[model samples]
Target: MSYCEDTIKKMLPKAYVRKHVAHEIYVAATHFKNLVPMMDKYVYNDGTTKDLMSLTGTIPVLFNDKTYNIPICLWIEESYPQTAPICYIRPTREMMIVRGKFISSNGEVEMPYLEEWKNGECDLVTLLQVMAVMFGDFPPVCIQPHSEPEQASCWLQFQRQAEVLSKTDGSFYVSLLREDDQPFQQDNETSC
Candidate 1:
């Protein structure tokens, strides 16, 4: 057995029902090698937390002739297979989540496939395929403009200054300082 299979079996050791879940996870891992299976804590909106199996990695989304690997996390509940896994788009520091019809502002994914998930019929591989297709049509994330390390640092500093100015004064002007000694004006005049 592969490492992923072993991990799934160990993490989801319930009984006969979980066997199917293990199989599904193993299949998904085989299909998407980039995704790694691990056990993690999932916190519910009601302040309840549960240790659950999760797959964290990227899914390839083809857009405009280029492929972009979109980072994502799939949290499988104990009652998975019976219920759909809670999915989220986990963007890196250099990326920003794009709220769209399929993805929420917080990166939570909601679609017809997940909404109408039926046990036995729905599986992880199919879910991932659907996600890829949907994301291709409407990307859930975009690469942040300030990708360079120096620019990123300048952006952070600008944000900090803006926050301080906002708290101290009602109106403030924010601009990002670039390495070329040019001021990237975000706004001419802004009131907090």
Candidate 2:
């Protein structure tokens, strides 16, 4: 096996967090050669430390309502060179849409498998491939959310639900917050 795969194998056996696909994710990322572009769009380039202290970082922002995780931040942690990086969500007022000049992929409205991506068997590379196969044909567009209060309320409700469910399972709950209140420092890792 290659270095990344070997590293993943080593980590998987010692992982304490149940349901953590960290190693699996790293393995897929290293093994999949064709996914380089997509991965870079979301992840920090090799050998570079991600500066997440600004408004942007490596974490991906995905909505529970979508098919493929769109308009996301790809996050890598300081422990990444030794451990798997953690991906997180970023909430934006601008309707989250696939970043492209043309509509190549459909938003959650058309993609059904997106909502479960994080916890599903699919990893970053697989998710990108699926995005190309399913959404590559269309152009990109600005996705309008339902409404301000409606969106906030829905997010709040989901946060509550996620908390309740996560307590039973070993899953982590993510919250939607304003850009100013962003808990992490981000430095626009991605141009978009």
Q: Report the number of the highest-TM-score candidate.
A: 1
Query: Per-residue lDDT for 1-192 in model 2, tens only?
Result: 233544444443332332244454554456442221122233343755533311122223233222332343333332333332333233355444443322322222234334444444545555444544443233122323344454454334333322222435664333333334433223331211
Taking the tens digit of each residue's C-alpha lDDT, what string does model 1 give over 53-128? 8889887766444466778999998778889999999887755666767888789999999999999899999999
Give all candidates' CA lDDT scores.
0.71, 0.35
Could you tell me the lDDT of residue 9 within candidate 2? 42
TM-score of each: 0.73, 0.28
Model 1 off-target regions past 4 Å? 1-4, 13-16, 147-192
Instruction: Provide the lDDT at 64 for model 2.
Output: 29
- Candidate 1 clash pair list: none
lDDT for predicted candidate 2 compared with the true structure: 0.35
| C-alpha lDDT of residue 162 in model 1 | 32
